[model samples]
Target chain A: MSPMPTESAIAEKRQQILQGAMEIFLHQGYEGTSMDRVATAAGVSKITIYKHFADKEGLFTALIEQIAEQRFNRVLGGIYLEKEPEEVLRHIATQILQLIASDEQYVAFFRLIMGESGRFPELAQLFVRALPQRAWKVLGNYFATHPKLDIANPEATARIFTGTVISYAITQYILHGEQIAPMPSDVLIENLVHLIVNQSSS
Target chain B: MSPMPTESAIAEKRQQILQGAMEIFLHQGYEGTSMDRVATAAGVSKITIYKHFADKEGLFTALIEQIAEQRFNRVLGGIYLEKEPEEVLRHIATQILQLIASDEQYVAFFRLIMGESGRFPELAQLFVRALPQRAWKVLGNYFATHPKLDIANPEATARIFTGTVISYAITQYILHGEQIAPMPSDVLIENLVHLIVNQSSS
Candidate 1:
């Protein structure tokens, strides 16, 4: 049985479902989870889940989109083009690593998204549409403003930089687990900053 | 409906099943696939597969071990530790990117292993036991001798450096589907070398 819902109440219920869904999705992955489990986890009726999201696919897509938007907005929002180039990039790199290390939900989310991306490719497309292209555009624009960088290829450089930070997190947390060697965040940021900043200046 | 295996032939049959299993596993993932599919793909009897591997778990474990050994050995083997540190690291990076980009079976194997790693944590452990630790030990030793370099944290730095490259390939090929980035491989290597070595020197 399902209760009739008002729009705002429905929205609140939807948010609750997404939060629970994120937890289960991150833990069990997409194929491993079910709508019934999500409904139970959310404390909402299964019919309520259906009413909010047409099916499991819809629910999953909505959940990914919602989080993607939040993540995109959060990370990208903090990245200011107006700042000095080196500082802005260092801030972005530090921001990325800090968020990956601290946010349990985010890491789980990334793991879930990556784990299932091969099976349900639209989830990947949703991520790509949300994040990378936008980051590239911002980065390219930033490099465009900095004629002194001597970077012949801003986009490629950005990929290299992006790859470096991401690979670090994956190795430390996901692949290597607790046995990984400890380096302070500042050391990483310092080394990375040195790599990106022009050395001729100093 | 199984033929008697000759003493010497069991090894050949096992090799055949393992080869076919990689393709099927890569395409369908762990749960979505079946032993029947693998047997059929291998052109071997179901009984033959069982005689060798007993069950899906056993078969998968063997397959993972085989692939991991091949992958880690093939990529890491080419880089001579005896070479200068900069040359060795650059060559290693290029080899890794090429492996991630071109080797579909390896990529598929990695994705499948990582995807199911949570449920079958032994697989993740297998990866750590096989690759990153050995790599760290080798790289750490290399960095220790390179006194002129300003590497404050050798092992952490290596992991970060490796992660960055892997993440780039995953984003470009597996996730985003950029078959080839605009830059040539050597040019890409040059740029990476610039960031890693030249930047540090200055």
Candidate 2:
């Protein structure tokens, strides 16, 4: 109507569609979701959704990719990879918990993925490739290079680091295990840091 | 027909209904699944299912409780609480992987829990209370009594232990992250045990 949508405007519209897709897909689930529902949720025409995404699968795949990039980049962005192990691990642990605390949507999306994994295995695969795979690699290389840590296997250590923190987040927030198995996130972070940086106890 | 079912016979039928509920609920989801579907899958009449389970929620609650007791008891039953940290931790780790490896049904049920947690928060709560809560308590108490490990806070340490191993299982089996971020379960188990008992490096 006004001028044709510019590149940035178009990108903004696309992001809006994805965000709406997340909400609808989570509520209706992958099988239950439809382009019509997504369009309604996004406040856009069905044709507009089709313009942005080839199909529901494409929309979902994009959703996984975007959520992964946004959350991981935000959590991993602040840390200087070269910092001491104690500082780096603490920063990572703190950032992860902080991000989970702030973002209910992301946590909900995680639930959707886990719940739908059996029906839509490819979605789970895309998520693994997008998020935890990258995390394991970055931390694995860090462990491998940090001679001081003396880790025999960097890859496994990387999984443990990311796994422990993520597990805590899932248990506390998603599983509501805080009531049943309460441990302050700070305590876990510090203890995890101590375990990794202070390995080889007397 | 036969005389009224004996106590053990009634118990067996109850178990069958729960198993069918798990399958239907896993496939159709919590909201999508109904008693009829469970009856068909379970080879029992809907009336029989009603005789045993009051509603879908009751059936699901029973599923959580039974799964927690069966797998956890199988895992925790063999380990003597009196063992050293190395022996105890390793035994728990191995037993978990073994159980996960052998039982696809349990793995699928885990995915179902994660996926359905959002819609049915109460189911998730039941699971945490039944499963992780017990594990955390046992391990926390074990760590507290074992002065040899010198753990300042056994509760957090217990969380780390269960959290790490469970996360590993989720990644390797549920997320299918093994190929992308491959670290054999044995490698992770050993590293985790090392971190816990081998803290305080030179």
Candidate 3:
């Protein structure tokens, strides 16, 4: 008996649905999740879910996009583009690790995406397109601005820099393996920073 | 009708079962997999799988142990306890990446384990205990041998090195997304080698 949701209200409701969907998807995976489950979790009716998202896949795509957008904004938010190259790269890696480790939703989202990636290849694509692509682009821009770093391949360097940080996080948390090698995150970052920031190390 | 198999033959057969199980487990996941599927993939009778492993968990455990043993042996195999520390460390990272990237079985094994890790928390422990533990031990031994690097905390350093390589692989293959960060594997190796080989800017 109430009035229909306004445009802003509808958008807000959609966000609420996505947040709930991410929680359930992270915990239960795409296959095991149901519209009823999402409805119950979001405290919305099943029809509302359908109204926002045509189906579960639609909901998932929206969630991934939202997470990707949030991560991109957070990492890109604090950059002092004109800072010293060494400190700049270090900050970027730190930001990346912090994102990977501190964000519970990010970790769970990563796990869910990775877990079902074989089945849902699109999810992986969305992540790369949304998050890593932006990261590499940002680093590439930084490198381009500071040609003095003598980094011949800024794009390649960006990938390696990002790769090293990601590798550290995955090994520590997901792999949870005993020290495959001894470089702690700080030491690793320090050494890596030294290697990349300098001009002639290659 | 055939000649009686020797003890080594029986052992070989057991290894074959484990290998097949690892593949199927990696592809199908724990919940999606069945003993019959493993047997079919292995080209062995159902009884052979049971003979070698008591159940699915037993097969998974045995697979983990086997992979751990192989990884440790490969990483530590040619490492001279007497070699210069920097050279040895770089060699280890380079070798580790080559192994992870090329070995189809390892890739499949990792994908399976990572995807299904949430359902089986014990799987995480098994992986860490088996692989990372031995890796840390090897790095520690290497550090103890080299007095030059003067690293106070070899354990942390080792973790970082391990994490970097894993991140590299995950981004390249597992996270496979569009506009992929394009860095030839050799470039990555060169960058890592640069980081580990030089302790000081001097």
- Please write out the lDDT profile of model 2 over residues A1-202, one tens digit for every residue: 6878689999999988997898888666676688888888888898998888888788987887777667667666666777788898898888888888678887887888887777667767778877788778788888889867777777877878888899998988988777766778898898888888876634
Can you tell me which runs of candidate 2 are displaced by over 4 Å? A1-14, A31-36, A47-55, B1-14, B32-35, B46-55
Model 1, A1-202: lDDT tens digits are 7987688986888899998888787777777788888888998888988878888988888888888889988777866766676787788988888888887677777777676677777777678667766776777667656865767667667766777777667655665455644456667766666666663322
Best by TM-score: 2
Count of clashing residue pairs in every prediction = 3, 7, 16
Best by DockQ: 2
The 0-to-1 C-alpha lDDT of every candidate, in the order given, reads 0.73, 0.81, 0.70
- Candidate 2: CAPRI quality band: medium
lDDT of 1 by residue, B73-155 (tens): 88777678666657877888888888877877666766776677667777777787678667777777676667656665566
lDDT of 2 by residue, B12-121 (tens): 99989988887887677776688888999999999998889787788877876777667667666667866778987898888888888788887887887887777677
Error of 3 at B65 (Å): 4.2
User: RMSD in angstroms, all models?
Assistant: 4.5, 3.5, 4.8
Candidate 3 TM-score, C-alpha based: 0.76
List ranges where model 1 is wrong by over 4 Å: A1-5, A10-13, A45-54, A80-90, A143-152, A180-184, A198-202, B1-8, B43-55, B80-91, B132-157, B177-187, B200-202
True contacts kept of 2: 0.73
